[model samples]
Target: MHGPASSGWLLVALCAVTGAYCLARMRSGAEGQRSAAGGEALMGFGMAAMAVPAAVFTPPSWAWPVYAAVFGAAGVHALWAARAGAHHLHHLVGAAAMVYMSLVMAGSPAHAHGRGGSGVPLLTGALLLYFAGYVLLTGVRLVPVAAVAGGGGPAGWGDRPELARACRLSMGIAMVAMLLTL
Candidate 1:
C-alpha cells in the first residue's frame, strides 16, 4: 500500500468532522431537505476519503467488501432521500457503480474467478464519467443561486444547498481519480 502515512487517520478525522457537522445541522431545527443535503455532503466526503486512498493503496481483497458496504449504504440513503429526478438518477448510477466495482474486486482471478479482464477498469471509467457529468449539471444549476445570494441569499453560498454542490464536485473529482487509477 502506497497510501499516505496518515491516510487512515485523515479518513477517520474527515468522517468524524462531517458526521458531527451533520448532527449539529440536524439538531439546529433544520428541515428534512436541508438535512438530506447535508447528509449528501457528508457522504461525499466519506466517498472521497475511501476512493482516493483505495486507488493509491490498492488494499487487500478483504477490503473490497468494506468499501462496498460503506458506499452501498451511502448510495441507498441518498436514494431514499432523493426527490428530484437528477438526484435520483445520480444515486442510482452511483449505487450501481459501487456494486459493480465490488463484484469486480471480489471476482478478481487472484480471488479465484480465473476469467480475469480489465472490464472493471473500463466500466469504472464510464461510471466516473457519468458521475462527473451529473455533478457538473447539478453544480451548474446551483451556481446562479450561489451567485445571486452572494452570502445574504436565502440559501447563502455556504449554506446546505451549496454544501451539497461542493460535495458533488468532490465526489466527481474522487471518481475521476479512481477511474484514472483503474
Candidate 2:
C-alpha cells in the first residue's frame, strides 16, 4: 500500500466496499456461504486497514503485532476449515500472506512505505506468484459464469455466484498489489 496517495485511497475504497458487501452476504447467505462470507469480510476489512497510506496514519508500534496475531489466528481457522472445501485453503493462504506482511512491516517500519527494502524476499515472491495465478484462474473461471448469469435482472445479493467469484478475484488482485508494496 506504500504507493501514491491516490492508489492507497483506491485500495481503501475497493476493500471497504468489498467488506461491506461481504457483511451483507454473511447475513443473507445460506449456512455454508454465510461462514465463507464472514471470513472474506474479515479479510476485506483487514486489507483496507492495512492498505492505508503510512503518510496519512502510521499505526502505533503495537499495531503490527496485533495484525499478525489476528491474521495468524484466522489462518489457523482457515486451515482447520479447509477440510470442508478448497476455498478455505485460499483463505488460509491469504491469512498467511497478511501475517507475513504484518511482520515485515513491523520489522522495518522505515520501509513501511517502500522506502528502503531490498528486493522482494523469496517468500514474498512465492506469495506473489500464488496470488497472480489465483487471480488469473479465478478470472477465467468467472467468465463463463458471468455470461450465463447476465441479464438475470440481478440475483439476490448473496445468491449470485458470479459476483462472489468476482469479489474473490478483486481481492486476489488487491493482494498482488499489496505484496508489491512489501
Candidate 3:
C-alpha cells in the first residue's frame, strides 16, 4: 500500500468488499448468525477505516486514543461473547490486536505509513507473522479441490463454510497489513 495509488485503492476495495459481504450476511442471516455476522461487519468497518487513503487525511491524534479505548471495550465484549463459540474468542483476539495497534499509532501520528527498518515492535511483528500464517492457511484451504463434491450451482458468499472462514482470515490479513503502516 505504500507503493502506488493503485495499491492503496486495492486495499480499500478489499476492505469495502469484505465489509459489504458481512453486512449483507447480517441482514439475511437468522438471529443466531446475525450476531456473529454483526461482529464481523464491525471488524470489517474498522479495517476499512484504517485502509482509507492515508495521504488524503488522517484522524486527529486524539481520535487514536478514543479508537484504542473503543477497541479495548470491544475486546472484552468479544471475550464474553466467546461463550457462544470459539469464533467469538477469535474476535476477542482481533479486537485486542486492534486495541494494541491503536495505542501504538496513538503514540505517534494518527496516520503514519512507515514500513521497513528494525523499528517494528516485537509484539506487532509477532502478530503480523501470525496473521500472515493464518491467511496462508486459509487460502490453502480455499483451493478448489471439491469440484465434484458439492455438485451444485455456485453458492452464495455465506453458503460455504470455508468461504466464510476465508473471509475472516482475509480480514485478519487486511487488519495486520494496515497495522504495519503505523
Candidate 4:
C-alpha cells in the first residue's frame, strides 16, 4: 500500500503535540479540573487516533464501521452536553462529520475502503467547507485572546485553558489537512 508522505507526518506530529498538551493539562488540581481535562484529553486522543492512521497508512477493513460507531457515540454524548451549553454543539458537528465519512466509506468496495476516504464528492466537499469555516472562525476568535495572553501565551505547564484551545485549533487544522488528502 502507498504510505503517506512528509505532509502527512507533519499533520500526525500536530496531533501528537495536541494529545500531549491535553495529557499535561490533566495534572492541574483546580476544581472541576479532572472532568474538564479528561474530556479534552479524550478529544485530543480521539483526534490523534483518527488523524494519524488516516495520514500515514491504509485503514483496516473494519475501520469505517468502527469510526462510525465511535463518532456516533461521541455525537450522542455531545448532544447531551449541549443541554448545558451551546459550545458543545461544535463537538456535535465534528462527530457528525466523522460518522458521516465513516458510513459513506463503509459502502465502498472492500479494496478501496482502506484508503482513508469516503470517495463521495458531496460529503468530502461539505466536510472541507465545514472545516475551512471552523478553522477560520476559530482563528478569528483567538486573535484578541492570543494578543492579550502576551509573550507567547503562557507556555509550559500553565494556562490550561489557552493550551487546550490551541490543541483544539491544531486538531482542526490537522483534520482539514487529512480531509484534503482524502
Candidate 5:
C-alpha cells in the first residue's frame, strides 16, 4: 500500500472486487453463510478504503479514529457472532487487526503516505504472521479435492465455497501487504 500508486490502485481494485463478491454472497441460501459474507464484505471494503493511494486521496486526521471505532464495533460483533461458528473467529481477528492498524495510523504524522509508527510493533508482527499463515492455509484449501461421486451442477455464485475461501485468501494477502506498509 505504501508503494507505487499503481500497486495501491491494484490493492484497491482487489479489495473492492472482493467486497462486491462478498455482498453478492450475502444472498446465499444458508443463513450462516449470509452472516459470514456480510462481515467479510465490511472488511473488504474497509481495507480497500484504507489502501487507497495517498496521492489520490488523503483522509482527514479524524478519519483514523472513525475507522478505529467502526472496526472496534465490528470486532465486538464478530466476537458475539463467533458463538454460532468457528469461522467468525477469523472475522473477529480481522476486525481487531483493522482496529489496531487504525490506531497506529491515527498516531502517525505521515500516515497519509501509508507510513505508520517508527517501527513494526509486536502486535503488527504477530498479525502479519497470522495473516501469512491464513493465506497459506486458505490457499491449500482452495485446491481441488477428489471429485464428487455425484457431480452436481456448478453452485450458484452466492453459494460457491471455493469462491468464499478465495475471497478470504485475497483479504489475508492484502492484510499482510498492508501490515508490511506499516
Candidate 6:
C-alpha cells in the first residue's frame, strides 16, 4: 500500500532516471536510432509509474510540477521523433494524458486522499485504452514480421526488437492496471 507521498517520490525517481537515460542515448549517435529506442523505453516506464500512482493514490499538490515537466518533456520528444513509428503516437498520447491528470490533481482540493469522482476514472480509462490499443497494434505488427523471418526480421524490429517489445508490454500492463482501477 504505497501512500500518496511515497508514490509521488516513485514517480519523480522514475522520471529522473528516464530523462537521464533519454539524454544520454540522444547524445550517443547522430542517426538518432538508439536515442529513439531509449526514449521509447523510458517513456513506457514513466507512463507506467505515473499511471500506477495516479490510478491508485491521488498525488500531492507539490507533485504536479514534476509530473508536468516530465510528461511535457516526453510529449516534446515524441513529437520530435515522430518518424520512429506509430509508437510515437502512443508516447504523445501518454504524455498528454499525464499532463491532463496532473492539472486535474493540482487543482483538486482533496489531494490528501483519492479523488472520489467518476470523471477521473472515465478519463483514465480512455487514456489507458488509447495507449493499450496502440501497443497491441504495434505488437501485432511486429510479431508477424518476427515470426515470418523465423527469428529477428530484417525490418525495424530486428534493429531494436527488445525496446519495441518493451513498449508494447509496458503499455499493455499500464492499460490493464488502469482498467482494473476503473
TM-score of each model, paired residue for residue: 0.59, 0.91, 0.79, 0.73, 0.90, 0.57
After superposition of all CA atoms, the RMSD between model 5 and the true structure is: 2.6
Full ranking by TM-score: 2, 5, 3, 4, 1, 6
Residue-level lDDT of model 4, residues 59-129, one tens digit each, is 78798788788888888988988787776787788778777656755665433434454564777788888
Error of 1 at 71 (Å): 3.2
TM-score of 4: 0.73
Model 3 TM-score, 2 decimals = 0.79
Candidate 4 regions off by >4 Å? Answer: 1-3, 29-39, 53-56, 108-120, 146-158
- Minimum summed lDDT over a 10-residue window in model 5 is located at 145-154
Candidates sorted on lDDT, descending: 2, 5, 3, 4, 6, 1
lDDT of each: 0.54, 0.86, 0.70, 0.65, 0.86, 0.56
Q: Candidate 1 local accuracy as lDDT?
A: 0.54
Error of 2 at 83 (Å): 1.0
Give the per-residue lDDT digits (tens) of candidate 2, residues 1-182.
Answer: 57777888888989999888888878653566687998899999999999998879888899999999999999999999999999899999999999999998887754454436578778999999999999999999998895223245545687677878888998999999999888
- Compared with the true structure, what per-residue lDDT tens digits does model 3 show for residues 49-107? 75666566567778778877878888888888888788787788788887887776666
51-163: candidate 1 lDDT, tens digit per residue = 44444355577876876787777677767766644565566566666656666655553323223453545666678678777767867876775422324646432346565
Who is ahead in lDDT, 2 or 5? 2
The superposed Cα distance between candidate 5 and the true structure at residue 140, in angstroms, equals 0.5
Estimate candidate 6's alpha-carbon lDDT, on a 0 to 1 scale: 0.56
Q: Give residue 123's lDDT in candidate 6 (0 to 100).
A: 70
Task: Mark the 10 consecutive residues where model 4 has the least summed lDDT.
Answer: 147-156
Q: Which ten residues in a row have the lowest lDDT in candidate 1?
A: 109-118
Question: Candidate 3, after superposition: displacement of residue 145 in Å?
Answer: 8.0
| Root mean square deviation (Cα) for candidate 2 | 2.8
